[model samples]
Target: MAELNGSPVSLEDLQTLALTNYGHFTSMRVDDGVIRGLSLHMERLVRDSRLVFGAELDPEKVLGYVRQAVAHQSGSFNIRITVFDPALEMGHPGVEAHPQVLVTSRPTGAMPPPPLKAKTFSFSRDLAVVKHMGLFGQLHLRRKAQLAGYDDAIFVESDGRVSEGGTWNLGFVDEAGTVVWPDAPVLPGVTMQLLQQAHEQTTTAPVTLADLPRMRAAFATNTSIGVRSISKIDAVEFDSDDPVLDTLRKAYAGLPDERL
Candidate 1:
């Protein structure tokens, strides 16, 4: 982990910290030539920053800086550039925001094995917006899961439908073999949207814990790992021998070249 634009972040953490009081940033994977929905994600970043500072937005400069950072990387690169607020101090809310930008890059860690390929988010004040500092919501969601004796939490809709994990999208393989994931009312994850649109390999549906019995296996998709297989849910574990997981992993792993 290194400080990008002075925002403390892990090399393994999702590459979103660049959006904080730290000016603007960009993240891209070089291994497979995958940029991780560069255009869409950048749009969200600029939109988030504009709303945060009431300033005119231009992500092109930020992206050009990010490309330069990527040039410093050796292999698959996860790069970020953050701008810290020069005008305001940390932990003081409602203060006028003047952010300074920093940029950094690093290789990603070993991906979470199987069904866990997805962005992981913790509950945070930055939930709605992608700001740099929000330790509360980040730790709160993780701790709640630990207290409940589960590996993690799958944020649910008020009506009881499964929405997303703190950082990843929810996906369950139905008894009939259809892979299901939620469509809207949540941040549109890069991997989730792409794989979900692949129809033959995946499909969309509102999922809930009550429907777990119908799930033979489950998985999640994200930019970090591509796609990971989930063996357990809320204490219930499933087959490690599932072949579908391997197939999906290979499918996505092959995507880098496919895109080129």
Candidate 2:
């Protein structure tokens, strides 16, 4: 069940959210009551809430709400927290004093598919930094790629530089065995941040469509998937058994978990 500010969501609540679904959100895998990089998750809420809603979000209040939502749940769960104002208007009159906090939890596996296949698409989001609610463009591109027989879509800039995946960040294992992230405008995902902290060789550099042919292997990172190998991007294929990918995965799994 979904909870709106520590209470069960009612029909009136759904109607209010449907009216104006403008907000920023974060999703993470919660094990029991602990989460890896819990501080980063709270930091994201504070930063995104200020940017999207023009108000500061008290981290303690958000955590209290999350704790309440997962109080009776057991095992791993996919938890999402949304920050928005129910009475928000479309134009200038929509500004609200305090944004509403909504938390929802549902049972889920530990990780997504091991390796993913992606197709390249020419698209970018409006605000690349904030993980906002509206994502029609990227979802549409992903659907189109799925219809064309690909697993998902990877977004590329007009200049041919690869940015990120539809709902994940891309990490490439170069020929030298270094984990290289594409130097482009994209949302810095929580999983990507954790991996970077785990491995010192993680670095950011320009990765273009032309550079894909030279990379030894690739992987995708996000809260839902963790670190997953990228089998193919369009016609180019990568080695799923690459040792570098395995090393990075082990490093990610070793990180300590924080309690809610």
Candidate 3:
């Protein structure tokens, strides 16, 4: 399903996003009319709208549209809310902005995805802190990784510091079982934030590719999959069934869901 400002989205308006690609979005999994980290998703929309469009977006208004879009849907599904301005042209992007909300939904995939084997690629996203629509570089690397016999790609900085995954945040378990989040400039994922808030043994540190061998376990975090184990990164392997991974997943699943 696709909706724009509570109405069906038109292909003419979608052309703007397809060509310019100057926008931001947030994706979340909704189940039974409720969503986890709904407030965080709203916060991200408001924040990114201001930064990318130089316009103010009301979270309550966005919520109203979201409620309308999900009204007829049942069971579990994934919803993506994209903020963009169809009237804004590429020639005069600096003009005053009027952002529009585009809501799209898709079927949710299997839960607790199978462990992933990621190949490390030397690349970083522009404005990595914002979840913008600039995904060419990341997707390109992911394709290259897949063609090379890996499940996915993990980004690494030029200085050898490990950053993030194609579309998720990466976390590691140290020898002592502490959850260590990479100290790199990556998008602050809502699921990762919720896990950090609920998990007691957590810390932030700079992780390099060379540091992977010292870690005992690793996992990927995103709204769709929650927490999924990473069995390998490059040549280093981790315990996919580590007890710490189970604890982290439970902690995230325990977070209370908010009504949409």
Which prediction has the highest lDDT against the true structure? 3
Error of 3 at 150 (Å): 0.7
Q: Please state every model's RMSD to the true fold in angstroms.
A: 5.8, 1.3, 0.7
Q: For model 1, how does the per-residue alpha-carbon lDDT over 1-260 read when each residue is reduced to its tens digit?
A: 44434345454333434333334433444464457566755676676667665565566766665555454445565655555455453456366765445566667866654432222232223443353344455457766776765555666656666676665566777777677776535656666666665447667777666776678887766676666777777655655456666666665555434221
> Model 2: residues >4 Å from true position, as ranges?
92-94
lDDT at position 200, candidate 1: 75
Q: What are the runs in model 3 whose C-alpha is more than 4 Å off?
A: none
Candidate 3's displacement at residue 39, Å, is 0.4
Residue 236 lDDT (model 2):
92
Estimated TM-score for each candidate: 0.71, 0.96, 0.99
Tell me which of candidates 1 and 2 scores higher on TM-score: 2
- Kindly report which residue stretches of model 1 are placed more than 4 angstroms away from their true locations once superposed: 1-28, 32-34, 81-84, 88-100, 112-135, 144-150, 199-201, 240-243, 256-260
| Best by the TM-score measure | 3
The Cα RMSD of model 1 versus the native structure comes to 5.8
lDDT of 3 at 37: 96
- Please provide, for model 3 over 59-178, each residue's C-alpha lDDT reduced to its tens digit, 9 standing for 90 to 100: 999888888998999999999999999998989999999999999999998778999999999898899979999899999999999999898999999888898999999999999999
1 versus 2: better lDDT goes to: 2
